[model samples]
Target: MSDSSGMPMTFTTGQMTSLYSLAWTPSTTGGYAGTCIFLIVLAALSRLLLAYRHLIEQKWHDRAMNRRYIMVSGQNETDRERRIIGGGGEKAEEAVLTSKGLDERVKVVRSARSNVQGIPWRLSTDLPRAGLFTLNAGLAYLLMLAVMTLNVGYFLSVLAGLFVGELAVGRYAGIDDNHH
Candidate 1:
């Protein structure tokens, strides 16, 4: 096909079916080889940028607090009540009280749980934050799929991108820390 400038466009399907080669067109001249290399490098850099953005999003979510409340009932009520009252005084007592008073005390818990056991309990409150991570996860998966195409150029590009991205943001994102 001819483009607006009347230069012919050539399309070729590579031998590898699994490899969904990127739709990059090299300039129709002796410099085509250089143009192809440039495009590959650009794609690699773009992948790195995407990874960096994902890391940034994760860091932001970690720092931002999305306030929510969880109701504690059943056998744990009395224990929770005592803990709240012990630390919070009259305000905590008043906060836990329902219209029926102490007989129906419902402990209001903060959304952010410190450990794994609290995940199920905090699902409702944590959904919004989870949604943010979901987007980052989706991008990561897409990058993985691209890598799976098994095109040597693209595969190397993705690997290099990941290595560079990790080096750039690993410490800032706390990925290098043992505690996390």
Candidate 2:
């Protein structure tokens, strides 16, 4: 039955069929878009945290440096005045800074990050270097696969890579199997 004419009916379509979707609809796009957005936001938050940490560290360093400047300048001015006033015994009042035996072992460790420039090459130079290359390459390939795959596959691959890499490292460095 028709509305009023009662014989036959023709339907009219609306213009806003696609526009019915929310302009900022995220939920409709399924998992990929939502997951990617979440990962992006996570990465951004982590980066911002790192930057804030760096800023705080730099602020502390700056404060320490400023204090050092005051102490150093004051000591210099004192020595200068002492020399101008005392004739010969100024050496008795010589300023000595407390360095506290900074052994630079920390520098050696931190330099690992900076001095990683020729790292692959350095690994090549080690004895039984093929093992190092294999270990490094295996770690890298697994890391790449991890970034691309589903969770279970990534976890399995990482485990396998770790075993292989550890075996290679131990063999190359002459460590017994029990060492690890």
Candidate 3:
């Protein structure tokens, strides 16, 4: 068979064809194999980006929780001090950390469900997340286009890439199973 350019189409071996664009045309079997490998790596890279975005989100959450803990813990300590000094009958052991105090801290930390810096959501904190989302989407669409070539080799390569990528990074990607 022949394409618009009159070059003999290599449908069987999936060679001698253009993929995605003119620049991606592979003229030989070896070139086509190389292209397949490139597609696999590119697909895997998209998963890596997803894992990176997850890491950033986790870090932000931890930071915000730590900040809230500090704020709440300090306030609790001050209140305890006042109660002890004002009453003067309570033992020094009352100043020790208790389960109730910890419960209060946890509650305070969980209540603030806003951005990393506490309440004010800024574009600066969101830019990296947005950029990664765009990049990951672009890579996914690029791989889809490659598969649209309907070449058996390219299709399998994309599938293998996704499997390998998930094995490597999907666990840390923080995708909830219930969402699926």
Candidate 4:
């Protein structure tokens, strides 16, 4: 079996193989091993990035909860009464437990937001999260491309990398599969 270029269209354990691009072909045993190692490291790094993203999310959640507490405590009796009346009493209490209180709390959080070196607080937190997401996405796509090569060695390398990555960082990333 062959393609238009006459290259065999089948999986092989041959040393000569192209990965991601023709220029990346590893034509020697050492080169192939290095490529496998690179893929392993790339997979591991993606997991590490995922763990960092989880940590950032946890941190932001904590901060948001703290801000909610501050808003609740900072409100005067009149403000609380007005909120209960304006939002409806039982609904207001539920709102305090949930999302509806966000609007009223914004003013207080804004002060803390502004105190952060003149940078908009949302931007400061959002940019890193967005950047990490973009990077993780790119890495994931690259790994997918590596798997698409159909070479048994490369495929096994990817699986091994994922296994090693999960063993190293899955717990910290909160990727609990067995409820443990």
Best by TM-score: 4
lDDT of 3 by residue, 76-175 (tens): 5556322111221233223324456423331222225565445445486578768877887898889888776767788888888888988998888876
TM-score of model 1 (CA atoms): 0.39
lDDT over C-alpha atoms for residue 12 of model 4 = 67
lDDT of 4 by residue, 41-71 (tens): 8888888878778888778755544442224
Per-residue error (Å), model 1, residue 113 = 8.1
Q: What ranges in model 3 sit over 4 Å off?
A: 1-13, 69-111, 114-119, 177-180
| Alpha carbon lDDT of each predicted model | 0.46, 0.34, 0.66, 0.68
**lDDT for model 2:** 0.34
Tell me the TM-score of each prediction against the true structure: 0.39, 0.25, 0.64, 0.65
lDDT of 1 by residue, 54-110 (tens): 565555454333333435567565554322222444555335544566543455544
Top candidate by lDDT:
4
Steric clashes per prediction: 0, 0, 0, 0
Q: Order candidates by lDDT, high to low.
A: 4, 3, 1, 2
lDDT of 2 by residue, 80-147 (tens): 32111222223323433235642221111111232324233333234434554455455444344333
TM-score: the better of candidates 1 and 3: 3
56: Cα error in model 3, Å: 1.2
